[model samples]
Target chain A: MEWIIIPDKKPDTHVEHIYREKTDKRILKRNPWRDVRLHGTVLVLVIIAELIGTIKIPITKDVAITIMPLIYTIILGLAFYLIKPIKWIHRKQARIAEGAMMLFIGVLIAKLAISSGQSIGLIFEMGPALILQEIGHLATILVLPIALLLGFKKEAIGMTNSIGREPNVAVVVDKYGFNSPESRGVFAIFIIGTVIGTIFISFLVTFSLSFLPLHPYAFAMASGVGSASMNAAAIGPTLAAFPGMETQIEAFAGFSNLLSFCVGIYIVIFIALPLTERVYDWLEPKIGRDSIMPEKEDDNNA
Target chain B: MPDLIDSSENVSVHGIFNWILLLFIFSVITAVGNFLGYHHPIEGSLIGMAILSFITLIGVWLERYVPLDISSILYISVIGIIVAFPGMPTSEFVLKYVSQIELLAIVTVFLAYVGIGMGKSWDEFKALGWRAIVITVLVIAATYYGAAIVAHIVLVLTGVPAV
Candidate 1:
C-alpha cells in the first residue's frame, strides 16, 4: 500500500547554505556602528517597547500571562522588517544585525550568571532538583513517533532530539553530515524556533501556570531549555506570577540554563542521538507515511 | 579545540575590537531600557551595564587566548559567579549595582536584534513547511513540560517545599 496521500519534496538546502554563509568575513569587514539606520530603528523600537511597559492579561482570577516590553520589541522590530514601505533594513543590514545579536546575548548571559553566582547558596540548596531537572530535556526524544507519523523520515531524528539551537545543529551536522536528512530536519526547526519560539514559550509558561499545581521553582528549572531568549521568556511570566521571588526565579532559571549549555550537548550526543536511532528504526516502519502534499502557494506570503 | 576555534573563525583580532564597541552600544541601549521600563536611574544602570560588559569582554578574551575549548558563555558565567559569590569583597558592590538593571531590559535589546535579524531568514522560515512547524512546536512543548514534570516530581521526593 502506497501511503501516497502526500508528495515528498526535497528538503531545501538553501536555508542551510545561508546559515553557514552569514559567518563569512563580510560580517567582520563592516563596522556595525556605520549602520545608522538599523541602529536608529532599533533604538526607537526599544524606547517604544519600554514605554508600553508590562501588560498582564488575566486568564482567570489567579492566573495572568504577562506581556512585557521584551515581547513587544521583538514583534515591533519584526513588523518593521516585514513592512514593505519602510525599506529601512535590507538583507545586508539584517545580516549585520544578526551578527551583532550573538554579541549582545553575552550581556544577558552575564547578568544571569551574576545572579546565579550570587545566589550560589540557593543553587546548592536545590542542587538535587536543579541537577535532576536536566533529564527533562531528554523527554524530547519521546516525541519521535509523532514526527515519524507526520511523514518525516530520518529528519525525525533532528526534529525530536533537541530544540535545534546552534549547538544542537552543529551536533547533528557533525554526526549525520551537513546535507543529510537529519541536518535538514534540525535546520528547519532551528529557523522556526528562532523566529517564534520565544513568543510561544512566554505564553506556554503562563498558560501552564494557570492549571498546574507544580511549584514555580519547578517551572523555573524547566524554563532552562538551553536558549537564552526562551529562558528569559519563561522567566518573565514566572516572575509575574510569584511577585517576590524574582531573584530566586532568575537564579534557578539561570543555573538550569547554564547546566543545559555546559552538559546538554554531551547528553544529545551520547544518549539522545542513540535513542533517536533506535526509536526511528522501531517506529518508522509502523507509523510513517509517504508524504502529505500541501496546496501550491507563495512561500513569500509569510 | 580546533573545531571550536574553526567555528568562531569570524572573530579576528579586529572583530574583537568591534565586538567591544558593539558591547558598549548594547550597554547604552540596555541602560536606557532600564530607565524607562524598570524605573531605575540611568547612572546606576549604566554602571551596572558597564560592569556586565566588562565581565563579558573578559570572557571573550579567555575564549580566544586561553585554549580552554569551552564556550565564552561558560567563562562569562564563572566570572559572574566568582565576583558575586558570598564572602567575596566585591559581592556587595557588584550585586547592588547589577541588580538595579532588570534581566528583561537586557532581553528586550537582545530580542530586538533577533527581530531585525529575522528578516533575512523569513523566506527560509516560510519554506520550512507545516510538518516542520508542527514537530518544532511539539519538541518545544515536550522538552519544556518534560523538564517541568521531572523537576516537580524530584522536588516532591526531596521534600522541598513548593513555592
Candidate 2:
C-alpha cells in the first residue's frame, strides 16, 4: 500500500518579502549600546564638572541650573545627529547646535519653576520664609516621583513590545497564559519569592546601618544601593525638609548618582549574566529537541 | 491519580493574592521604619521592599508557593512611581543646586546605561574581561572614598560645621 501526503500552501510571496525587508531595516537601525555609551559619557562629564565647580559661564545660579539639563539633552541630541564618523569641525558644529536647543528648554523649565515660587535660589537663602512656601516646595519632591513613574511605565511598556520578532506581551501571555491556572500558580510563586528576598535583605541592611554611627551622608549612600532613582526620590526630600541640611542634600544628590552607577555595575555583571545563563540553559534542553543539524549529521555519516 | 495531582497543583498561591500580600508587607515595613525614626522616606521604602523580598523567599520553601507575575509588575511600577515623582521637598533645594542634582541623576542614568550597554560591547572588552571587572570595582571604590575625601576637604576649606 502507498500513502500520499499533501504539504500546506506557502504564505504569500509579497508578504514574506515585506516582512524580510522590515526585519532587515530594524536590524540596521538598532544601536542601543552606542546611544547608551554616548549618553553615559555626557553624564559623566556633567557630574565631574558639577563636582569640581568648573561649569562657569557667568549666568545667574538659577539660570545656570536650568540651563545645565538643557545642555545635557542638547549634547545627547547632537551626539545622535553626528553618530556617524565625521570631521572635527562638523562634530563641533553639531554639539553647538544641540547645546543651544537644550539651553532653551532648560531656561523654559527654570522659568516655570521660578514662576511657581519653587525657585532653588529661594531655598538657599536661610530666612524665615513662611511655613507654606517651604512646605510647598517639599511637596514637589513627592509629586515629581509620580510624573517620573508614569514616564518610565510608558517607556517600559513600549520597550517590552519592541524587542524580538513577536510582541513581548503577547509572547509572554501565550507562553505563560495570562489567566490560565498554571500561569497563575507560577506567578504566585515568583511574587512570593521576590517579596521575601527583598524584605529580608532590606531588613538586614537597615538593621546593620542602624547600629553603625552613620552620618546622613552615609545613610544617603545606603539608600542608593539597589536603584538610584528610588534612593534619590526617598532621601532627597527628607534632606531638603530637615533644617540646615541644604549642603547635605546637594552632596547626596551628587553622590547618589555616582553610587547608582556602581550599583548598576554590580547588577549587570553579577546579577544579569548569571540569571541569563541559567534561563538559556533551562530553555536549551526544550529548544534542542525541535532543532536539527542535518548537515553536520550527514557529514558525520560520510 | 488525577485528583491527587490536581490537589497538589491547587495547593499553590494565587498571583493577585501574593501581590496584595507583598504590598501589605511593604507598607508595614515602611510604617515600622517610619516609627523607628528613619529620616528618609525612600530609605524606608527600600527597607520595606527588601524585607518583603526576604520573607517571600522564605515562604517559597516553607509554603512551597510562589507569586510571580503580579510581583514583577508591582515592583517595577512602585519603582517607576518613585522615580517619576521628582517634585518632592527637595525639588526647590535641588533646583537651587540644580547642577549638582541633575549632574548626579544624569551620571547615574548614564552609568546604568553603560552597565547595560557592556553586554552589547562584550566583544570589545572580552580581551580584558577580568581586568574590566576589577577596574569597574576599583572605580566604584575610588569614587566612594574620593567623594568622602572631597567632602571633607571642602568642609575644611569653607569652614563648614561638621554634622
Candidate 3:
C-alpha cells in the first residue's frame, strides 16, 4: 500500500532499508531485466501450467466448473515462491516482479481493448446496463454492517470504501493519513485482495454460472470490477462456461474494466467514501462493538 | 547489470523504454503459451504480438504528451477501438492475427507474475488477522455478485434474453 513492503523482522541490508523507507528513486533503479532467475522461473511455470491443460470438476450433474492454465500458473508460481528452501526467489526479486507485473499487464490491456473494439456494436447496445453495473461497486458498503457486527470500528470504512486497489489506497492515505486505523484497514485488505482476489473471483464466477439465471453478457459486464487480473479471472471461466460467447464476453468485460479504471476514482471519493462514513456513523451505534482485531503472533496460519 | 543503471533517472525515457522492453518480453513469452495451451502457431502469435505492442506503445506515447490526467488505458482503448472498429483499414488485419492469440494465454502470463510477486507479501498477509481476511472475501463477493445482479436486472428490463 505504501508502494513499500514493511517487514515484520529487523532490516539488515541497504536494499531492505531502501524498501522500508520507500525510496522510489532507488527502488525503481533495480533493473527488472537483471532478475533472470525470476524470468526463467516464469518460463518453467508457464510450461508446466499449459502442459497440465484445463481440468473440469463436476460440481453437480448438470453444471461443471473448470480450471485453466491461468489458474495453474498462479498456483505453481506461488508454490515455488513459498517453498522457503528453494531460494529460487529473493524478496528483492519479488519486488522487481511486482514492478514488472505493471509493465506486462499492458499487453493484456492492448489485446482486450482490440477485442472490445471488435464488439463495439454489442457494447453500445448494452451501454446503459454496462455503465450501471458499476453501481454494483457501491454494494461493497453491504459489508459495513457485517464488519461492525464482527467487531470492526472505523476500519470497516476503509475496508469497504472501495475494492482497495492502488488508487483506492491513495484515497484512504490522502484522507486519513498512513498511520490511521482506516489506512491500516485499507492496506490489510488491499494486500489480501492482490494476493488472493484473482483465484477467489475465478471460482466465484464459475460457481455462480451453474445457479445464476442471469445472461452471460451480464456476468461479463459485471466481471470488470477495475482490477485487470480479477477482470480476466472473471472472464476466463465465463468464456469456458459459454463457449460461443468469447467475443462479446471479452468486449463487455474489457470496456467495463476500462470504465472502472477511468471513472472509479471519482466515484469512490465523492460517493462511496462519504456514503461509507455516513453509514458507519448511523449503523455503528445500532449494531456495533468496541472490539479491535487482536494482534496475535500465535495465529500464523496465512 | 549495466542495463540497470545505463539510463538516466528521468521517468520519461528510462521508464518508457523499460516498459517497452517488458511488453516485448511478455509478448514473446505469451507467444509460447499460445502455442502450447491454445494450439495457435507461434508465428501467428508473434504477428499478433507485434500489432498489439504497436498499439500499446502509441497509446503510452499519447498518454505522456497529451497534457491530460486521463489514464494511459483510455488512450490505448481508444486507439484499439479506432484501428479495429469494423470498417477501419486495419480492422481486418488486426482482428485476424490477434484472434489467433487467445486471451487466456496472456492471462496465464500475467498471473504468473502476480503470483511470484506475491511471495514477499506472505508475512504481511498473515499479519492481517482472521477478521480482515473474512471481511475482504465478503467485500469481493458483494462487489462481483452485486454487479452481476444489477446487470441481470437491466438486461431483463431491456429484453435482452438470458443465455
Per residue, candidate 3 scores C-alpha lDDT tens digits across A1-302 of 33444345643222231121132233357656656798888888898888998999887799888888899888777777898787868776677777677556567788889988899988899998988888878999999999899888878999998888767877887798655678767877788897789899998998898888788888898888888889888888888888988888889889988878878788899999999999999999999986675453234233
Tens-place lDDT digits, model 2, residues A1-302: 00111125542111111122232222122221223333334444334333333132434433221122222322333343345552232332322222221111122122122222332332233112111111111111122122122221111111111111112222323443343322222222222211121222222333333343334444433333323222322333334323465444543433333323333334333443244334434543443332211221111111
Interface RMSD of each: 2.8, 22.4, 2.7
* lDDT top scorer: 1
Q: Tell me the tens digit of each residue's lDDT in model 1 across A70-133.
A: 8898888787888899888777677778878766767888898888888899899899988888
Best-to-worst TM-score order: 1, 3, 2
Over B40-159, each residue of candidate 1 has an lDDT whose tens digit, in order, gives 999999889989999988886777678556777898889998998988998999999999999988888888888888777778778777777888888899999989999999889888
Model 3 alpha-carbon drift over 4 Å, by segment: A1-28, A293-302, B1-8, B12-15, B64-66
State in Å the error of residue B18, model 2.
38
Task: Give the DockQ (2 decimals) of all models.
Answer: 0.55, 0.02, 0.56
Worst 10 residues of 3 chain A by lDDT: A12-21
Candidate 3 lands at a TM-score of 0.90
Q: What is the lDDT of residue A259 in candidate 3?
A: 79
The chain A TM-scores for the candidates, taken one by one, are 0.88, 0.23, 0.88
Q: Rate the local accuracy (lDDT) of all candidates.
A: 0.81, 0.29, 0.80
DockQ for candidate 2, please give it: 0.02
